[model samples]
Target chain A: MVLDGIAKTALLGVEMGMTLVLVTVGLTLIFGMMDVINFAHGSLYMLGAYFGLTVVSVTGNWWAALLIAPLLVGLLGGLIEYFSIRPLYGRNPLYHILLTFGFAIMLHGLVTEIWGGQVQNISTPALLDGSVDLVLFSYPLFRLFLLGVSIAVTAALWLAIRQSDFGIVMRASAHDSEMVNALGTDVKRVFTAVFVLGSVLAGLAGVLLGTSQAVDPGMAASIIIQAFAIVVIGGLGSYRGAVVGAFIVGMLNAFGPTFAPQFTDALLYLLMAAVLLVKPAGLFGNPEAT
Target chain B: MSVKDIVGRHFSAHAETDVLSGRVRLGLFVAGVVAVLFAPVAQMIHPFWMDLVTHMFIFALFALSLDFVFGYAGLLSFGHAAMFGAGGYAAALLIQNVTSSALLVLPAAVIIGAIVAAIIGWLSVSARGIYFAMLTLAFAQLFYTIAFNDIPAMLLGVDAVTNGDNGLVGITSLTLFGMDTGSLMSYYYLALVILAGMLALVTRLANSPFGRVLQAIRENEDRVAFIGYNVDRYKIVAFTISGAMAGLAGGLWVPFNSTATTSMLHWTTSGELIVMTLLGGMGTLWGPIAGAFLVVFLEDSLSAIGNWEIYLGIVYIVIVIFAPRGLAGIFQTVRSNPHPKVLLSRVRSALVTYREKVFS
Candidate 1:
C-alpha cells in the first residue's frame, strides 16, 4: 500500500512539476530577454485556458483546442507587446511591472465579464481519460500525457533557445542587446517574439492544467505567485533552474500535506526565501542577476 | 526638435517645478480632510460614503508608508501588506489577550510592524530593484500562508489563531480608557487623528536630512554609498519606518473593519498599495494620501457594478504611461500654467508628440 502511494505521488509530483516547468520557463524567458517581469504572464495563462475552453466547445476537440488556444493568446500577447509595452522600453523597468500588473487586473475583469465568475471545469479527452495500470499503482493517463507534452515542449524550447540560428541571435541579444542592435538585428522584434512565445507557454500550461483544476478569473492571481516562487527558487532566468525548481516545488505541493499539512501552500515561498538568503542569485542563476 | 525631445522636455520641465509645493500641498491635505469630514455632517454623505472615507484614511496611511520606502529609497516593495497585516494581527491578538485599549494596542502594532519589517528589510536590502521586490514578495507570501493556515494556532495546538480564511472575528469594539468606542463618530475621530498625525509625521520626515539622503540613494545608490551613507542601513531603516506606519494603518483597520483577514497580508494589497501610491504620485508624501482617497472612493462607488477593476486598470495604465507624476503632478501643472489656453495647448502638443513616439 505504501509502495502504491509512493508511486502515485511520484507520478502526480512529476505531472505538477511539468506544468510548473511550462509556466516558469515562460516567466524566466521574458525576464531574461527583456528585463520585464511580467505579472500578466499568469493572466495570459488564464486567457489561454478560457480560449481553450472556447475552442473545445466550438470544435468538440480537446486536441484542436490545445493547438489553437496558444496561438490565439500569443497573437494577443504580440499586440499587447506592440501597443502597451513597447513605449516603456529603455525607461524604468518599474513601469513594466505596473503596466503588466494593470494588464493582469484588466484581463481578470475582462475574463470575468465574458465567462462569468463561476468556476469552469474541463474534462480530459476520452482517449486520455481513465487510469493506466502502472506496475506499482494505477495512475491517470492524462497526467502521464501531460508529462509527455511538457517534456516535448521543453525539448522544443531547449532546441529553439539553445541550438537554432534564432536561438543564437536570441541568446546574443539577451547577453547584450546593444551589441546585437549594432550587429544589425532589430532587438525590438526579438522582444515581441520572445514575449509572444512566453505567452504561448502560459497558454499551453493553462490548457493542460485546466483539465485537472478549476478555471476561473482568479486563476491568474492564484498561480502567478507560484510561478514567481518557482523562477526565483530556480534562479531567475535560468532554464535548468526552472526545471529543477519546478520539481522541487511540485513534489512539495504534491506531498507536503502528509508532513506539514498546515504549511503545504507556504513551503515553496519559504524555500524561495531561503534560496534568496543563502544564494540570492539562485542556485542556477548568475550572481549579477540578483 | 524631434518628438522624443519635445515630449522629454515637457516631462522634464515638471521634474524641475514639481518639488512639491510644500505649503500648498499641505493646505490641500487639510482642506481635503475637512471636506471629507464636513460633507457627512452636512447630511449629504451616506453612511457608506462615511465608511469609505474612513477606509481611505487607513489606506492613506498605508500608501504613505509605501511611499516612504518607495518614493524616498527607491525600493519598490511588492509585498508591503506583510507589515500591515502583521500590525493588524498583532493588534487583534493584543486586544483579545492583553488589553482592550487601542492606545496600547496601536503602539504594540507599530513595534511589531517595525520588528517584522526590520527583519524583512535586513534580508531584502542586499538585492537592488526588482530582485528586492521579489524577495519582499516571497517573505510576504510566507506571512500570508502562515496567517492563512493559522500556523501559530497549529503550533500552539489551539483551535485557531488567525482563524484561517474566516478571519479573526469579534474584534468590533476598541476601548479608549475603558470606554467602548461603540459609536461610528468616535471610531472616525480615532482614525482621523492618527491618519493626520502620520501625514504630518511623514511630511516632516520627507523634509528631513534623512529623507534627502534616502532620495539621494534612490537617484544613485553607488553615488550615495560613495558619499559615505550606509545605503543598505538607510534602506532598511526607511523600510522599517514604512512598515511601522503600515502596521498602524493595519491596526486602525480592525476597529473599522471588525475583522482582520488574511487578505490584509495578500500581494493584491501590496499591488493595490503600489497602484494607489503611483496614482497620487511618488516622491511626494501627500501624493499617496491623495491617491488613496481617489482610489478608495472610486473602488467603493464602483463596487456595486462588476468589472470596475478593468476600467481602473486601464486608467492606471494610462497614468503610468502618460502621467508618471500622477495627480500631484497634474495639480502642479495646472497651478503653474494658470492660463487654460496655454495649459490645454501644452497638453495637446505633449499628447500628440507622445502618440507619435508610441506609433513610430
Candidate 2:
C-alpha cells in the first residue's frame, strides 16, 4: 500500500513537473534572449488554451486544435513583439515589465470579452480519455501522454538549442546583442523569433493544461506566479535550472499536502526565499549576471 | 554626462521655479485637506463621494508606501499587497477578538506589517532589480494560496483559520476617544486626519538625511555602498517603513469596507497599487494620491460601462510609453511653462507624427 501511494505521488509529481517545465522554459528563454520579463506570458498561455478550445469546438479535432492554436498564438506573439515590446528595447527593464503587465490586463479583458467570465473545460480526445491499468494502480492516459510529450519536446529543444548553428547565434546574442549585430547577424529578428518561440511553448502548455483542468481567466495569474517562482528557483535564463526547479516545485506540490498540509502552499516560496538568501543568482544561473 | 548629471542640471535650472510652484502645490494640498475635513458639515456632497474619497485616501497612503521603496530606494516590489493584507488581517482579527480601539488596532497592524515586511525584505534584499521583484511576488502568492486553501484539521491538529476563500467578516466598528465611529461622517474625518498625519510624516522622512541616502541608493547602489553606507540595511529599513504604512492603509481599509478577504492579499491588489503609483508618478509623495484618486474614480465611474479593464490597460500602456514620469511630471511641465499652448502643441505634433507613421 505504501509503495502504491509513493508511485502514485511520483507520477502525479512528474505530471505537475511537465506542466511547469513547459511554462518555465518559455519564460526562461524569453528572459535569456531579451532582458525583458514577460509578465503577460501567463495570459498568452490562457489565450492558447482558449484558442485551442475554439478550434476543437469548430473542427471537432483535438489534434488540429493543438497544431493550429500554437501557430495562432505564436503569430499573435510576433505582433505583440513588433508593436509593443520592440519600441521599449534598450530602455529601462521597468518599461517592459509595466508594458507586459498592461498587456496581460488587456489580454485578460479580451479573454473575458470573447469567452465570458466562466470556467471552461476542454474534453480529452477519445484516444487518450481513459485511465490505463497498472499492476498496483491506474493512471490517466492523458497525463502519461503529457509526460511523454513534455519529455520529447524538452529533449528536442535541448538538442536544437545546444547543437544547431542558429543556437550558436542565439547564445552569442544573449551574451552581447550589440556584438552579434556588429557581426552582421540580424539581432532584432533573432529576438522576435525567440519571443515567438517562447509564446508557442506557452501556448502548448496552456492547451495541455486546459485538457486537465478548468480553464479560467484567473488561471493565468496563478500559473504565471508559480512559473515565475520556478524560473527564479531554476535561475533565470538557465534551461537546465528550469527543468530542475520545475521538478522540485512539482514534487513539493504533490507530496507537501501529505506531510505539512497547512504550510504546503508556503513551502515553495520558502524554498525560493532560502535560495535567494543563499544564492541570489539561483543554483544554475551565472553569478556575474545577477 | 551621466543621466543623473543631466537630471541634476535640469532640476537646478528649475530650482527657482520649483520653490514658487512647490508653495502653490502645498497651499493647494492644505486647502484640499481643509475642504475634506469640512465636507461632512457642508452636506452638499453625497455620502457616496465621501466614501469614495475616504477609500482613495487609504489607497493613496498605500501607494505612497510603495513609492518609498520603489521610487526612492529603487526596489520594485511585485507583492506589496502581502504587507497591506497582513495589516488588514491583523487589524481585523484584533478588532473581532480583542479590542475595538483605533489606537490599539491601528498600531498593532502597523507593527505587524513592519514585522512581515522585515521578514520578506530579509529574504528578498539579497537580489537586485527584477529578481528582487520576483522574490516579493513569489512570497505574496504563497501567502495568498495559504489564505485561499483550507487545511485539514487532521494535518495541523487545529481548526482551519483564515476561513479559506470566504474571508473574515463581522469586524466591529472602531471607537476613538469616545466618539461614535459607526457614523460615516466621523469615520471619514478620522481617516482624513490619519491620512494627513501619515502624509506629513512621510513627506518629512523623504526630505530627511536617511531618505536622501535611499534616493542615492536608488540612483546608484554600488556608489552608495562604496561610500561606506550599508545599502542592504537601508533597503530593508525603507521596505519595512513602506510595509508599515501599507499596513496602516490596510487596517483602515478593513473597517471602511467592513470585511477582509483573501483577495486583499492577492497579486492583483499589488498590481493595482503599482498602477496607482505609476499613474500618479513614482518618486513623488503627493503623486500617488493623485493616482489613487484617478484609479478609484475611474473604477467607480467605468464599472457601469463593463469594459473598464480594457480602458485601464490602454491607459497604462499609453502612460508607460509616452508619459513614463506620469501625471505629476505633466503637472510639473505645465507649472514651468508660461503658456499651456506649448504643451498642447507638442502633444498635437507628436500625435500627428505618430498617426502618419501608423497610416504610412
Candidate 3:
C-alpha cells in the first residue's frame, strides 16, 4: 500500500511538473531573451487551447489540430511583437506591463465574444483512451501519452537551445545583444523569432493539457498568477530557475489537495510570499539582473 | 490674471489651481454645476441613476487612493483591491456583530484597511517596480484565499464570520446618530460627503513638501536615495495612506449595497481600479474622479451587451498608446493650442513620429 501511494504521488507530480514547466518556460524564455515579462503569456496559452479546440471541431482530427494550432498562435505572437512590443523597447518596463495587461483583457474580451464564455472540453484521440496497468497502480492512458509528448518536447528544446548553431547565436545575443548585432546577426529578427517560439511553446502546452482539463477563459487569470509564482519561486532571473520552480509548484499542487484540501489555494500563494520575503530576487534569480 | 483668480490662488490646493492655470478650478466648478442641475431631474426619472452615481462616488474615492500611490509614489500595486476588500469585510462584520452606526463602523474600516496596507506595504517595499507589484499581488491573493475559503468563519466555527461565497450580506440600513440614510438620495449625499472630504484631504496632502518628495522619488529613485532620503519608508507610508483611503471607499460601498463579497477583492476590481486611474489621468488628484464617473456611467449604460470589457480594453490600449496622460493631456493640448490649425499639425506630427517608431 505504501509503495502504491508513493508511486501514485510520484506519477502525478511528474505529470503536473512537466506540463507546468512546458507552460512557464515560454514565460521565462521570453523574459530571458527579449527582456519582456509578458502579462499576455497566459492569455496566449488559453488562446492556443481555444484554437486547438476550434481546429478539432472543424476537422474532426486531433492530430491536425495539434499540428496547426501552434503555427497559427505563433503567427499571432509574431504580429504582437512586431506592432506593439517593438515600439516600446527603450521605454520604462512599466509600459510593457501596462500594455500587456491591456492585451490580456482585450484578448479575453475577444475570446468571450467568440466563444460565449462557456467552459469547453477537448476529447482525446481513440489511441490514447482508457487506462494502462502499471506495476504499482493503474493510470490513464491519455496521461501517459501526454507524459510522452512532454518528454519528447523537452528533449527537442534542449537540443535546439544547447546543441544547434542557431543556439550559439541566441546564447551570445542573450549575453550581449550589441556584440552579436555587430557580428552581423539581425537582432530584430532574432527577437521576433524568439517571441514566436515562446508563443509556440504556450500553444503546445494548451493543446496537450486541453485534452485533460476543462477549458475556459477564466483559467487565464488564475493560471497566470500561478505561473508568476512558479517563475518567481524558481527565480525570475533565469530559465533553469523557472524549471526548478515549476517542479516544486507541480508537486505541491498535486499533493496539497490530498492532504489539506481547504488550504491548497492559500498554500501556493503563501509559498510565493515566503520566497519573496526570504529572497526578493528568487531562489535562482540574480538580484541585480533586472 | 483676473483679480478674482489671483486672490483664489492662495486658498487653492495645488498648482493646478494657480491663477495662471485655472482649468482644474473650472473643471471642478463645472462638475459642481452639472451635479446640482442633474440631481432632481434624475430623481424624477428613476432612483437607479442616483444609486449608480453613488457607486461612482465610491469608485472615484477608490481610484483616488490608487492614484496617490501609483501616480505620485510610482509604485504600481496590483493588489490594492485587497485593502478595499479588507475595509469592506471589516465594516460588514462590524455591522453584523458590533454596531451598525456609520460613525463607528466607517472609522473601524479605515483602521483595518490601514493595518492591512501597512503589513502588505512593509513586506512589499523591499523590491522596486514589477517585483513590488508582484509581492503586493501575492499577499493580497493570500487574503483573498482566506476570504474565498471563509477561513475566519471556519476557524471560529461561527457562520457569521465567514465568507461563504457571497460574503457578508443582509446588513441593516446605515444610521448616523440614529438617523436613517433611508433613500437613495440620502445615501448619495453620504457618499458625496465622504468622497469630497477624502478628495480635499488628498489634494492638500499631494501639494505638501512630503508630496513633492514622493513625486521626486517617482521621477528618480537613485537621486532621491543619493540625497539621503529613506525611500522605502516613504513608499510604505504612501501605500498605507492610500490603503486607508481605499478602505473608506469600500466601507462606504458595503453600506450602500448592504453586503460585501469576494468581488471586492477580485483582480478584475484591481484591474478596473487601474483603468479608472489611468483613464482619468494618473498623478492628478481629480483626474481619477472624473475617470470614475465616466467609467461608471458607461458601465451603467452599456453593460447590457456584456461585451463592454472589449470596448474598455480597446479604450485602455488607445489611452496607453496615444494619450498616455489621458483626458488631462487632451484638455491641456486643446487649451494650449487654442487654434485648430496649429493643433492639427502637432497632432499630425505626433502620429508621424509614432508611425516611424512602429515601422522602423
Candidate 4:
C-alpha cells in the first residue's frame, strides 16, 4: 500500500513538473536572450488563462480558445514591446525592472477592473475531462494532455532553434544586439518577435494552468515568483536548465506539502540556493556571457 | 560659451554658492522636523490622519532602507519586505510568547532582522544588478516560507510561533520603558522618535566615509574592486544594514497594527518601498521620507476611486522620464544653481523644480 502511494506521488510530481516546464521554458527563453527580466511574464500567463476562459465561455469550445488565446496574447505582447519596452533598452536595467513592474500592475489593474477580483473557473473540454485509472490511483487525463503538449512543444522549440534561420539570428542577437544590428539584421524585429513568443508561451501556461486550477488576479504575482525561482535555479536563460529546473521545482513543490506544507516556497528557494552555492552560474549556464 | 562650457563656467563661478546648499539643507531639516512634530495634531482633528502619519513613518523607515541599497550601494533589491516581515514576525512572536516590553521586543526584532538580512545578503552579493535583485527576491520568498513553517502561528498549526494565515493576534502594545504604547499619542511619538533617529543615523552614514565608499562603489564598482576593496563585502554590509533598518520598521509595525501578518513579506510590499524611495529621490537622506509621505498619501487617496495602480504606474513612468532625482532633487538643484538670483526668476525655477519632482 505504501509502495502504491509512493508511486502515485511520483506520478503527481511528474505531472506537476510538466506544468512548470511550460512556464519556465518561456521565462528562460526571454531572460536568456533579451536580458529583459520580463516581470510581467506571469501576467501574460494569467492573461492567457483569462483570454482562453473568455473565449471558451462564449463559444463553448475549449480547444479553439486554447489555440486562439495565446495568439491574441502574442499581439498584446508585441504592442507592449513596441510601446513600452523598446524605448528602455540600453538604459539602466532598473528602468526595465520598474517599467515591467509597472506593466504588471497595469495589466493586473485592467484585468481586475474588467473581470472583477473574484476567482474564475473554466471546465476542461469533454475529451480530457475524465481520469485515467492506473494501478495505484486515478489521475486527471487533462494533466496528461498538458504533459504531452509541453514535451511536444519543447521538442519542437529545440528543433526550430537548432535549424531555423530566425533561430540563428536570435542566437546571434542574444550574443550581442549591437553586433547583430551592425551586421544588418533588423534587431528590433527580432526583439519584438522574441517578446511575443515569450508572452505567447506564458499565455499557453496560463491556459493549461487554468484548466488545472482556478484563475484569479493575484495568480500572476504568485506564479511569477515561482517561475523566477525555477529559472534562477535552472540558470537564467538556459533552456535546458529551465527544463531540468522546472521538473525539480515541480516535484519539490508537490512533495513539500507532504513533508511540511508551509515551507513549500522556502524549499524551492533552498534548493535554488544550494544549487547556486555549488554552481553560481546554474547547471547549464556558461560562467561567462560569452 | 556653448551650453556645456557656460554651465561649467557658471559652476566654477558658483563654487562658493554650493556652501549655501548647507543652509537650504538645514532649513529643510528644520522644516521636516517641524512637520513631523505638528503632523499628529491632524490626528486630534481626525484620528485617521494620525494613524496615517504613523503608517507614513513606518513606510519612511522602509523606504530609507531601500535608499541605502538602491541609492547608495547601487543594489536594487526586489525582496526587501522579507526583512520587514521578519521583524514583524519576531515582534509578534515575542509579544505572544515572551516579554511584552516594547523596548526588549522591538530591539530583539531588529537584531533578529539584522541576522536574517546578513545571511540572505551574504548569499546574494555574489551577483550584480538584476541578478542580485532576483536573488534577493528568491531569498525573501524562501524566508517567507520559513516564517510560515518554522515559526509558530505561521502555518501547520504553529500558532504559538506565527499564528499561521489567521496571523498572530492579541499582540500586546508597546510599554516602552513602562509607558503604555496602546495610546495613539504614545504610539505616534514612539514611531516619530524611531523614524527621526533612523533618519539621523542614515544622514550620518551618508555623510560618513562608509557612505562615501558606498557611493564610490555605486559610481564605479569595478574601480573600487581594483583598488582592493572587497566590493562584495561592502555590498553585503550595505545590504545587511538596509535589511536591519527594514526590520526595525517592521518591528514597529507589529505594535502599530497590533498584529504581524504574512502579507507583510509579499513582493508587493517590497515593490511599494521601491516606489517610495524612487519617488522621494534616491540617495538623498530626506528623499525616502518625502517619498513615503507622498506615496502613502497618494495610495490612500487614489485607492478610493479605483485606477490607483494605473495612476501609480503613470507616476512611475513620469518620474523616470522627468524627475529622476525626485522631490528633494529640485530643492537641491535650485539651492546649488549658481545663476544670479533675479526677481521672481529664482522663485519660479524653484517652484518648477519642486512641482516637477514632487507634486507631479
Q: Pick the candidate with the highest DockQ.
A: 1
Model 4 lDDT vs. the true structure? 0.80
| Per-residue alpha-carbon lDDT of candidate 2 for residues B173-216, written as tens digits (9 for 90 to 100) | 78898665887777877887887788778777876778889988
List candidate 2 stretches off by more than 4 Å.
Answer: A287-290, B1-24, B30-38, B41-45, B149-161, B338-341, B348-360
**lDDT, candidate 2, A191-272, per-residue tens:** 8899899899989988888988878888888888888888888888888888898999999989998887768778888888
Error of 4 at A287 (Å): 8.6
lDDT of each: 0.86, 0.84, 0.83, 0.80
lDDT of 4 by residue, B1-360 (tens): 689999998778655433224665687678667756675677668878878888898899889889988998889998898999999988887887788798788888788778888998898887788878887887787767665555544434543566456677777887877778887777877888888788778777776678878988999999998998988888888888898999999999988898788788878788878888887888876788889998888889998998677787777766754566777775566556756565257557645664543322
**How does model 1 fare in lDDT?**
0.86
Going through the candidates in order, their DockQ values are 0.71, 0.46, 0.68, 0.33
Q: Model 1: what TM-score for its first chain?
A: 0.96
Q: Which digits, one per residue and each the tens of the lDDT, describe model 3 over residues A104-189? A: 98889888989878999888988889999998899999888888887787778767878787766777777778898899998778
Give the winner by TM-score: 2 or 4.
2
- How well does model 3 score by local distance difference test? 0.83
Best by lDDT: 1
- Candidate 1, residues A51-126, lDDT tens digits: the string is 9899999999999989999999999999888888888888899889988998987898899989999999777899
